[model samples]
Target: MAGRQRWMTVVCVVGVGMLTTAGCDGTAEPAAAPTSAATRSVTPPVPRDLFSPRPEVVRTPQEACGGTPFRAGAVRAYTPDGPRYDGPGPHPVKLLRMESDLLGMGPELPYQWTGPRPAQLVVCEYEDETFDSRQVGTCEYLGGTVLGATARVQSARFVYRVFEARTGTLVRQFTLRGNTTPEETCPETTYAKTALYDQQVESKDLVAKIRPLVERDR
Candidate 1:
């Protein structure tokens, strides 16, 4: 009987130990994993000159004259290296209107100007092309190379003007002209030539001449 009682005590102690271990295990909580730094979102840095008051000029589709007008916006100015930011208002002078009346026969070109209240600049293009051809061979040589073959003459013109928006006083004017004799087989269209003339030549000349006049007015 004592041996059976000791065996029962030993079994009870083992059972209690197992139950205590299970209870402790059930009460314990699991630890959470920490978040990783790599998963966080980050924004890219913007260019400093993006908002530096320099206008953006983009070459647009060609128009009737086969000359594409460069669309200018975002900021305002002539060029990054050519002119300083003229500011956002009451430009040295406002552009009222420009009339090319090209060769004294073409229609007056479109033009405009303004300041903080209204921002406007009109640049127009005029182009004309002529084709001349002649035949100099007999029926035997029909379709053969002609005497004159083909001759094409293309002329492009641009006029820019600025005037005081309020008083209609002319501030500056520029006349730019260029000619191209494309191959005889080439079509009657060119791309972005007018934009180049205005942006590269006319605008540069205008700024150089008018900058001094503008200072005097101030």
Candidate 2:
């Protein structure tokens, strides 16, 4: 049996944090007394394995280029760092549409901006693409002196972290891991790239995980 070697490629997209607001009178509120554990409201623990097997990836140029047409008087998505623009584009608008559609909020709930409003905001802490490849065997020439190698993507991992738009508090997070089947091959069809491009699947999984939190906040 031959040994296998593996490597990973990672791309990270990070969101900004929110700023704390001061009181109208510029006076800090006093801390409340601590309550007993039994009386306190306990948040449910996040599952250790929040994984989806078949995640979505970008497939066609149409899907890649699709999103809501730019319209004025729409609410804007505010991150802790600053406002995130979802204007017409290849990737940004597509991402916005995917997220909003999955959440059943149409294409204008979280990213448009009209004027002064409440402090509610949304933040995408990070979106990571982890592509993994491994060596199955070594290739040797007729002389058996020079060697070559072939590698394929065994699986791909995507992690998304979302936070409250105004407060910068993390609302929910999840991971999706898709593995290539035996019939899937490298060079011809890269499984990792396919999975990474399929934005719909990833957006669906993300919305499924965070829908409850979003509703509760609303």
- Per-candidate TM-scores read 0.24, 0.28
RMSD of 2: 26.0
What does the lDDT read for residue 22 in candidate 2?
39
**Every candidate's lDDT:** 0.32, 0.34
lDDT of 1 by residue, 96-170 (tens): 122222122222221322223232232333231222222221112123354222323334454544433222233
Q: How many residue pairs clash in each candidate?
A: 2, 19
- Candidate topping lDDT: 2
In model 1, which regions exceed 4 Å deviation? 1-155, 171-174, 178-202
Query: Model 1 clash pairs?
Result: 94-163, 95-163
lDDT of 2: 0.34
Tens digits of per-residue lDDT for model 2 on 1-218?
12767665432222223223334354644444555888887868755555434442323222222213312232233333333322222111112332323333221222322124322324231223344534333212222223332333233454444433433344455665433333332233322312222222233454455445443422
